[model samples]
Target: MAMRFSENADRMDVRYVAGLARIALSDAEAARLQGQLDDILAFVGELKKLDVSGVEVTDVATEAQNAWRADVPIAGLEREATLANAPLARHGQFVVPKVIE
Candidate 1:
């Protein structure tokens, strides 16, 4: 099945991946990556069917949570330091380069 699918990787069904990712992979690159992806998927398919009769399921193998100090107000950067790299500023807001037409 893997070999057959890889050999016929030219079908447009595979190209939809590039469109969804906003990429323009060339024919060679797409074909190459398609084969790799198919192989990975096939391996995962095999893994999914494994029988783990005694294994435990957890959200994560090593569960952890965030630890941090309490949030509190403190002194902040001085105005000179805050505007050091800004091209323009009005009031206290740093102006940014125009990104819209």
Candidate 2:
């Protein structure tokens, strides 16, 4: 039988999260997302119940570490060349409309 999350979902908390994320969600969307989030949490809870005493805890399966390339200074485009295509330029820099007062 499939687990029902409609009863388990916290509607208010889901709305709070949506608000914090600066997203606009309708009542229908909120209800749908609440169920989905509840379902994910329930799945994680179920996974926590599994016994893994003998299993090795690892963040990654491969032995290879993060490979990084040496940072070398390379000549880039000149200041005038970069500002040439700007819609507005001030003091040799691109000028954009102020968003925050």
Candidate 3:
């Protein structure tokens, strides 16, 4: 069953979440997104009402195995060649503009 929520409650919750996430939203945008989020939550709530007592649960959904290659050491670019592309380099390292005081 879909859960019902008040418009005021939805607006408040969505606005709070948007604020915490540092997202700027106008009143119209917040109202629109609030309705969308509410619909999603309602659908999830409906799914929770399903009877899955006989269903088997597994960690993975697919039978595919890990296709990762074996770790093997390979030749890498020389330090001189690597540093040649750096816009700024100091003491054998790339020098970036100071971001923090």
Candidate 4:
């Protein structure tokens, strides 16, 4: 079933959305955002009215495939080379400050 964006606009609360997103919005900001949200819903509603029944469904817009090269195992830098530029290294590993108590 197709979802109706316009019908859900009335139920969309800007303050509620902001709270869920952990954002603090003033009364004026909420009002502004609410209007913008309504406009977006109206636009989506217009899009829902388009005739797309004849269009073929595709996962990607382009025909390109296997975009990435084969991942082959190769020798990495030696331990000494890898830790040469580190601020602190001991026992063939980086020594960073304690992050947790």
Q: Give the top-scoring candidate (lDDT).
A: 4
lDDT for model 1, on a 0 to 1 scale? Answer: 0.70
> In model 4, where do residues sit more than 4 Å from their true spots?
1-12, 72-101
User: Candidate 1 at residue 98, lDDT?
Assistant: 77
Query: Which pairs clash inside model 1?
Result: none
Give lDDT: candidate 2, residue 63.
96
Best by TM-score: 2
C-alpha lDDT values of all predictions: 0.70, 0.76, 0.77, 0.78
Better of 1 and 3 by TM-score: 3
How many clashing pairs per prediction, in order? 0, 0, 0, 0
Which ranges in model 3 have alpha carbons more than 4 Å from their true place? 1-12, 73-101
* Residues 1-101, model 3: lDDT tens digits: 12333643432367777776768889899889989987877766676689989889789978999979889989999989999989999898999889589
Q: C-alpha displacement of 86 in model 4, angstroms? A: 19
Q: Write the per-residue lDDT of candidate 4 for residues 1-101, one digit (tens) a residue.
A: 22333454544677777776768988899899989987877777787788999998789988899889788989999988999999999998899989589
Q: Each model's RMSD to truth, in Å?
A: 8.6, 8.5, 8.5, 8.6
**Descending-TM-score candidate ranking:** 2, 4, 3, 1
Stretches of candidate 2 exceeding 4 Å from the true structure:
1-12, 73-101
